[model samples]
Target: MREFVVQQNQSHSVLITGSTSGIGLAIAHCFARAGHHVMLHGLADNETADALRAAFAGYPGNQGFSSADIASEAGCAQLVADTREAIGNPSILINNAGIQHTAAAHEFPSDKWHQILSINLSASFFLCRELLPAMRAARWGRIINVASVHGLVASENKSAYCAAKHGLVGLTKVLALENADHNITANAICPGWVETPLIQPQIEHIAREQQIDLETARAELVGAKQPMARATSPDAIGELALYLCGDFAGTITGAALPVDGGWSAQ
Candidate 1:
């Protein structure tokens, strides 16, 4: 991971969804270390959530955890309200919660498709709808969506995920244009394969299905789309996210930046 030195400033309230682990957790830590009040939202066991909250308390700003299920409109509303009550309105919102299911489009379960769309695409819209007003009033905000390389390209057996991410990128563009006058920047980060708990299951499944060792499975997975021939570190994505929220990125908006080891370049 690269080292970054964030300029000192007054704390900004940051709300990150699906922050219990993986990419979301990394982004939360990045913001917290930069002296931002961070509220982590995810579904996890009490012990796990408490541990994360305890760790976050050691950081420089107010830190808390929320177990709000953001896959529904009502849940998204409640999460926004609860966050506002806990840490005021968030000036930085990271929509990093997502789930993946693999199956041919013809065989994909209807319920799974709905769930994916709700959490990955619809939840972002709901959160933005509830939060953008306050951000506009504040006249400064950042909306970062953790999209995937699938947002820009396609792969077999990932129909729902691809669709949701594509929709997310489009939504990001619209938000950026609509909020340009308000000093609110909206963008999407399209990461390729990253070594996270979310993708570990898929890696293991590849090992089993391809009858290869775990190491070979990992290599093959990365070889397919990433020219670097390795999965990205979650911290790398975190670093990019931190950069996007910094002062230098004020002019950057409505972009789908790919941190994919050149996967999208292909």
Candidate 2:
């Protein structure tokens, strides 16, 4: 156990996975706007990475992009190496990359189950292992895991997703406890019904199957679990991530904070 460093309002170097689009993109923007140098990561080609990097040119701090595959332990290490080369060692790490598949537990494909766990759960572990040393040395760090509301509650036909997210929540708690005295806070943000491109196909399928308009389909999809009858915006989740990294939230660790429109309340 070591003493905690009270860091505030200082520009930090950040690494965000799955940041080419969706929720990850939103979170990247928030941190960049706040003057933190950001390393945006995803599985994209050079051209796409350049375009993504250009999009952040207007931000106050530096932005870098990487398409490093985080599906393996080596890939995760490579991503951390690239980030260190691009923007100093990242003081902030956001594990936002995940994939989903729908099938009953009995019908779930073994390959899909392994893939989901590798990317969603194991990649985070690898990255944390790679980054924790520097953070502990510096005596200040923030780790925000973008887990799902399913991490807090179960959902049928999402066995792999549920398992990965739930494991991620458990991991967050352990990281928090291990680093409590080192000033590195670890927390998970559990979002439900976010209107990302990832879920657009499901929404369309619901609309077609229910014989309803897209707007109605959207409502029904969200209303099924979330009590607010609307999806949470990616920006809202981004704001929460930003706040968690701030001085006021220094002591808030090991929390599975839900931004699920009260879905977890039900």
Candidate 3:
């Protein structure tokens, strides 16, 4: 596990959802390295949470803890209350908790779709809604939503994932407009493919199902699409999120930035 570290004399405090692993973890580390007071949120993983806290035990502005599922109203309320007590209200927010399943559109499980939408889309909205008042009063905030290439373009058997992300794009735009005067910026990061745990099993499943090498399985999805012909790095997205929250990005908002290595263009 990568340990999150905090740079000295940092002024920013950020809350990154689902930080126990993958892109979320990278984002937490990136902000921490910049010396931001980092709130690392994972979903109900006490063991992982303990390890993460141990990593930041001596750090200046780092802490690790679990947050409830923001997908539900009750969970969202609890998260806000606990965060308010633990850390100061966040100046930056990253909504990155999400899940996916591959099923034909008609056969897609309604329960699964509900779960995905509730977490991926609704959770973001609620977190923002809950946090916005404090952010507005402060007159400065950044909201970065972790969308996917599917948010901009559809592929086979990921209807719910795609729809939730698409809805996020719209939400980002509206929130940006609503908060424009308050120095609040909203944006979405749409990645093509990143070698995260969420996609690791998908790779194995496809490799076994299609009788192909792992590289071949990866290529089949990214084939001729991304000019780089590779998966993205969570660190890279983390860096971009850092940029968006910095002074230079003060004017950027509601933009869907694709870190897809040209997948969307193709």
Candidate 4:
């Protein structure tokens, strides 16, 4: 891991989407602490965005924040433009922005389906298209798509999410193959039952409905599919993302690495 840390003279600019909170925020911290100039993007309010940027003030790297929506080509373009204007051309892109909608395939709202695909899958493509040229020109790049366990396996009532994640995994592979000779590597990180703010309400609901403690509720939640019965910390995913950007991970492209507590192994 020490070899992966950015040296003072070799800092890279990173653009992490959906980085105001949760897993995305964790990834942003990882890069910033490692002395990489980081562009943090999320749909956070101005106050919250300011606070997040402030938290990184002590880190060695420069940090910038943006709230540009990335659900369309225009939004993606704006995000890339904002990132370049704020930080620099992003040599490292983490497509961590995502949304979720749960419903049976036939019952799923069409709008929700399109929304999920737009943010989860299409946005990554557009961002990569915009940033890859700079990376190629520099002869260094890392693209990490924050996919999900659903990318490798299916869950009930998550048709849209599964489809989008699976598509992202596929896109990662294609990007990896296409850029193999250009020093750009693309990979997907598929995490299951990550402890994020988005899942806090669900945990609380389970605790209340089952008359159990929060810890037990969390265990019950992950135990449903994960044999380890544990949720991966967002920091763990962030660490992996940081590593993937390092010299040691240069040959690990086109892989869907699972941090799922053995869920995908089943």
Q: Which ten residues in a row have the lowest lDDT in candidate 4?
A: 1-10
Q: What is the full ranking by lDDT, best candidate first?
A: 2, 4, 1, 3
lDDT of 4 by residue, 1-266 (tens): 34334431388899999988899999998988888999999998889987987899999878888888899999999989898888878889999999999999989999999999999999999999999998788777899999999999999999999999999999999999999988789999999999888888989999999999999999998899999999999999999999998767879999999999899998
Task: Please say which candidate is ahead in TM-score: 2 or 3.
Answer: 2
**What C-alpha lDDT, on a 0 to 100 scale, does residue 87 get in candidate 2?**
92
Q: Can you tell me which runs of candidate 4 are displaced by over 4 Å? A: 1-9
The residue-by-residue lDDT of candidate 1 on 1-266, one tens digit each, is 02212321457899999998899999998989988999999998899988997898888888777888998899999888878888888989999999989899999999999999999999999999988998899778899999999999999999999999999999999999999998889999999989986667767999999999988888888888899889989989999998898867888999999988899898
In model 3, the number of clashes is: 0
lDDT of 2 by residue, 1-266 (tens): 11333356778999999999999999999999899999999999889988988899998888888888999999999999999999989999999999988899999999999999999999999999999999999888999999999999998999999999999999999999999998889999999989788778878999999899989988988898888989888999999999999878989999999999899998
Clashing pairs in 3: none
Cα distance off (Å), candidate 4, residue 195: 0.9
TM-score of 4: 0.96
Residue pairs in candidate 1 whose N, alpha carbon or C atoms collide under 3 angstroms: none
Better of 1 and 3 by lDDT: 1
TM-score of 3: 0.90
Error of 3 at 209 (Å): 6.3
Q: Model 3: per-residue lDDT, tens digit, 100-173? A: 88799999999999999999999899999999998899777889999988889888899999999999988999
Report the number of backbone clashes for model 1: 0
* Shift in Å, residue 36, candidate 1: 0.4
